[model samples]
Target: MTTTVNQVMTSYYDAYNSEDPDRLAAVLDDSVILRSAAGTGQGLPGYLDTYRTMITTFVDRMTPQRIEADGDTATVSIVNTLTARADVPDFMGMKLKAGETLTLNLRGRYKVRDGRISEIDIELA
Candidate 1:
């Protein structure tokens, strides 16, 4: 059985909320690529580091407001509320420290292949 792109994204949010490494890896493919304003990462290791930062620095929540899918690709509009528990390093060129909180409007474009996320691009709005 294969999952839809939306399903993959839902699992991604769930994994992030849970802060479980294994669960995070389970939602992606071996060849996944993650791109954002901060940097680009190829494969699981690359993505894992980004997730690690979130796991360590901030207690965050990603809420999807809109989702549009066609075939193997999808676009998601999201609201991310983040509260820093530690000094978060160089996020989009800014340094964030504990006690800082912000809500960001962001979008993510996803590509799914074989029931796993193959690629994702995130941008701020």
Candidate 2:
């Protein structure tokens, strides 16, 4: 398969939204680092643990508004729909009540290495 930065990003989101850690891992380097408002995770195991928490804590979906790629780097602007699960954790400086939902604009900057994601940094919009 031909691997492009866009393809890598699509794969990353596809795997993430599907809640498939194994597939998600396929697009990341073993030394990958993910940083966000939530927290930071390093390497494959750290990422999987973080994903597990997300799967358990919230039902979230991402809508990409823009994708820009240059060389092995890419940036995506996205709208996120987030709904708290029954047992949700605190986020965005607020305690989530049951069934509470939020819509947020976010951005993700990524770097690719050998057709895999080497780093991702997320920021609020």
Candidate 3:
């Protein structure tokens, strides 16, 4: 059986929300590229490093408001909430004290191939 684009995206979100790096990695192609406000990352190692940094610095959650897929491409509108685990003087140009929460509306474009995510581009909505 083949995984649909929706399924791949669902798995990605689930893995992200669960804060499980291994599971997240499982759904991503080794050569995946990620572009977001933080920066661009190529390959699994780069992605993992970014993931670890964010996860360690804050408690993050993504709520998808809408998802649309065509062929192997998908776009998702999401409401992301991040609570500072500790004081952050500078985080993507934002400062937060411990327990402070930041919410952002974002759009994520994804390309999946062979049941894994090959590329992702995230931008402010």
Better candidate number, 2 or 3, judged by TM-score:
3
Give the alpha carbon lDDT tens digit for every residue of 47-84 in model 3: 98888888998998998889999999999999999999
Error of 2 at 112 (Å): 0.7
Q: Give TM-scores for every candidate, taking all chains together and pairing residue i with residue i.
A: 0.89, 0.91, 0.97
Tens digits of per-residue lDDT for model 2, 7-94 = 8888888888887788888988998999997778789899788878877788878777888999999999988887888745558777
Which consecutive 10 residues in model 2 have the weakest lDDT in total? 86-95
TM-score of predicted structure 1:
0.89
- Model 1: per-residue Cα lDDT over 40-84, one tens digit each: 889998788888877678888888898899999989999998888
Q: Give lDDT per model, in order.
A: 0.85, 0.86, 0.93
Alpha-carbon runs more than 4 Å astray in model 1: 88-90, 93-95
Best candidate (score: TM-score):
3
Question: C-alpha displacement of 118 in model 1, angstroms?
Answer: 0.7
